[model samples]
Target: MNQIKKWISENIVVLFFCMLCIAAYTIAGQNPYVVASDLINRVMRNSIMVLALIIPILTGMGLNFGIVVGAMSAQAALIFVTHWRLTGVAGIAAALVMCTAVSVLCGYLLGRLFNRTRGQEMITGMIAGYFGQGIYLLIFLVLLGTVIPFWDDQLSISTGIGVKDTLNLQEGMKGALDAAYKLPLSTVCIIGFAIFTVYTGYRLWKAGDEEQKAGRRGRIVRWAGLGILLAALLVIPVTSAVIRRCSIPVITLIFILLVSLLCQFVMNTKLGQDFRSVGNDIHIAESAGINVNRIRIIATIFSTVLASWGQFAFLQNMGTFSTYTAQQNVGTFSIAALLVGGASIDRANVKQAFIGVVLFQLLFLLAPAAGTKIFNDSQVGEYFRTIISNGVIAVALVLHAMHKAQENAKAAAEAEV
Candidate 1:
């Protein structure tokens, strides 16, 4: 085959998978179309979390494995909000604030750590994630009672070392966020993410102009997007009714969108360009007068804030927090999801993260059923899903290293040649 045809043939696997999925959905159920809606919702819910990785990826710092640190901040904020009896959008707002504060601090620290350990950012980030988890656990489990004030017994452990096995947030607010009685307006925010994706694509199409131009200014887009986001934030309740309503998750999503867009806008500014440049090539950026270390610090902080927002969304959706294990493994899995979405080691877009979350989650949600169809045993499916999710991360990391190796080899060979 010619090169063009060969390229198409090489991508045949994706086409085949798409066709296979359609076929299986049609064959497996009486309501394949109904199933499609659930799939879409799952995609919408998970995509923005994936969207959070874009900045770090743009800066060539690799996946924000330190996003776990941000996730910890979010979970901590969530716990406090719940303990304080904050409900509805107010609770979510407060949680975001708390999460952002924690994320900024965590990001600042992580940036310093990364700066000290430069080339091993991924490993430094991974270790930072663990370090944050320990700190997070201490706050949630041990410190909340003795040092911090905890009024609720449910939130406080019997031994007072940590929270209980599971802290049901609704016992305080009673499904204030997830109540089906509310409107499903949050769906609009999900739609907003889609709209943002479309806008990003449009921007990509206009990249040549953008690159050559001074700056986007982005005033009209900014004001208009903010106005729409605020409207959706207000309508989250009314919109929740159209679908099975979940207010908190929707609120969390809108918050995340606003934050991510804010981050995107930041990336597009002069400072933002400098930030990207530093990530692209630190030596060049530094020579050009960019403060590479500061940019790295700022980038880490940005990643933390977004990840914290993501964790807030995740928790608000579940309306329950697993005290011990909930926040620990976030970075490993989330970074994996981004990788699965076709993001490379040094670059990721918001859309890729969204696609990865949806695709990864579709498999997560359906693998048991899909497995039952194939293996007639869902337990087997469950086990396999665990393996697949972890395997995706492991493979991505390995692929990242291999790709880096190839780049170094090619550069060296070219120099020699």
Candidate 2:
């Protein structure tokens, strides 16, 4: 009874929303298939990004507003990608690489800056994102086409100097990655594998399997064997025309797998230990000979760079960018998605990232449709969604603060006792 009560308390919001959704489904006449599919896609795209927020939280770095700065770096890379008319997975790859390099460089710079303002990391990140955007816009608006040389006339505006209002990569890059796989099968399979890998890694960490973690060569061997088996399973699909459909799914799956593994690896490194220690006690970390400043710099750089890749992933799907407001409020939506993914300031995990995306996106999927059915107004649905997403994040932050204060009080009391 206590366990059940605790679960209910922790997830009351999810339960209420879910119950509301079921009620709406029963009341409204909507296709279950479309709703489910849309919800699934939303999860796939958002889960990875939300997972990005989990690490910093684990290290007690707070929600990384610096992530937005990374997104800007990606957008800058994308300006050229779309301009070149590279549509398929190739385009996505080039853009990711470009954004990554740019983000890494910028991330290092921001992280260093952050080292100076340790207590105010979150606010500092917020300002950094804003400042980064100015540089992003300047490069896109000015140096891109003329000095950069945009070969793809299709992406250029009627004026020929600026990019078009919208980018149409449907013919070029639309489902390029998705098209590389076997319709929906590879898509699900790849994501499933990625999820499984992360889960396994989590289990390893939780069990405190130092020997297993230390066996780097053994892990590589196992991966190789698994790869051979997977390749065999994919033989028939490859022979058929289904190979194209596997492209996006394969790439996306690989991307997720790499990030998850990267996270796992980082947590085991000396640098990772530094982050963990800093989270526990900054002053102690400094005393222990860990250059607390250097760690902060590294973390910031890594976070922003990854954020840049996420933005690229997002824009590639949108197939367009507004010269004026392309990234205007994407930061808010992304943060909402992360918080909705169950990430708090001090603690988060891959499980939370996944579950959060599912729940958050379910609401997103239903908001317009649900709102229209209930309120008899589509615009009302939009209004509710906008308000609720923003509101949920604020509430989560407050709740986290309250929880932390209570924990601190309990610890202090125990110490006194």
Candidate 3:
């Protein structure tokens, strides 16, 4: 009973959101296939940005709202590529290269700022994001053709002194990654199950005798689940309308999967261990001879670079870029999505990030329909989404503060004893 209560306490936020999602889905009464399709697209577009928050959180840097700078980096690169009339994969590749370089520099500066404001990294990050946006605007809006000496009628203002408000990527730049390859949704599902089955079997085989025995039932259940899922995939009709209509963006998903894998792999490495050490206790980490500030900086840099790439993918998928406001909500939305997945200020993971993206995006998709159904006004849903996004972050911060206070109190009691 105590364990159950603890579990609930730990995951109450996730449980509440899950129930809320179900209610929204029921109220919306949308077609499952349409919902699934929309969810998949959103997941692909935003998952990387959400994942980028994990490392910084793990390093005790909180949600890294400074990632908006990274998004700005991506937009800058995209602007350059678009002006150069680059197209397709080559354009994306070039933009990524430029984005990486720019984000690294921005991240380093932001990291320094974070070090100066250690315990206040979250607020500092938010401020840094605003500062970066100001600089971004000044460059593109004021310095483009003047100090920068850039000239493109389509991209530049009438006076040729600055970039335009919107940049169309309908050329070959749009869907550059997503359109590279496609597979039926059913095929993707089958492949996913097959991979899971093999991975599960491999884990079982690799476990030692005692360990294997301890987890024997759990392993068997996992294998059974995989088998059932695979069998269903095989038996499901390929001629089904949904299966035929819905397709997966193979390359885009591969990129998302690779980022997910990278997140998992990094957390198991030495640097990742340092991140944990520093995050858990900076003073202890410094005493242990770990450069806590450096680790935090690296975490910030990693997150920034990933955010840049994520923003790049996001814009490409949309096939358009809003010059001034494209990156405005990157920080708020990504952090909120992460929090919605039940991650705290100091602890997050790839699974939580992905789950959060799916749920958050699902809610966003359903909000309008659900609102229209409930209040006969779709605009209410938009307002509801705005509230939920901002509210989730606010709520998570309060919960984190309470949790930290409880821990500190318990520690104080122990020391008194």
> Model-by-model lDDT, in order?
0.68, 0.67, 0.88
Compare candidates 1 and 3 on lDDT and give the better one.
Answer: 3
What is candidate 3's local distance difference test score?
A: 0.88
Q: Residue 225: error of model 1 in Å?
A: 25
Better of 1 and 2 by TM-score: 2
How do these models rank on TM-score, best leading?
A: 3, 2, 1
Off by over 4 Å in 2: 3-29, 87-89, 143-152, 183-250, 405-417
Tell me the tens digit of each residue's lDDT in model 3 across 97-139.
9999999999999999999998999899999899999999999
Better of 2 and 3 by TM-score: 3
lDDT string for model 2 (296-334, tens) is 777777677667766665665555566457666655666
**What would the TM-scores of all predictions be?**
0.75, 0.78, 0.93
Off by over 4 Å in 1: 1-34, 149-151, 171-256, 395-417
Worst 10 residues of 1 by lDDT: 9-18
What does the lDDT read for residue 144 in candidate 3? 87
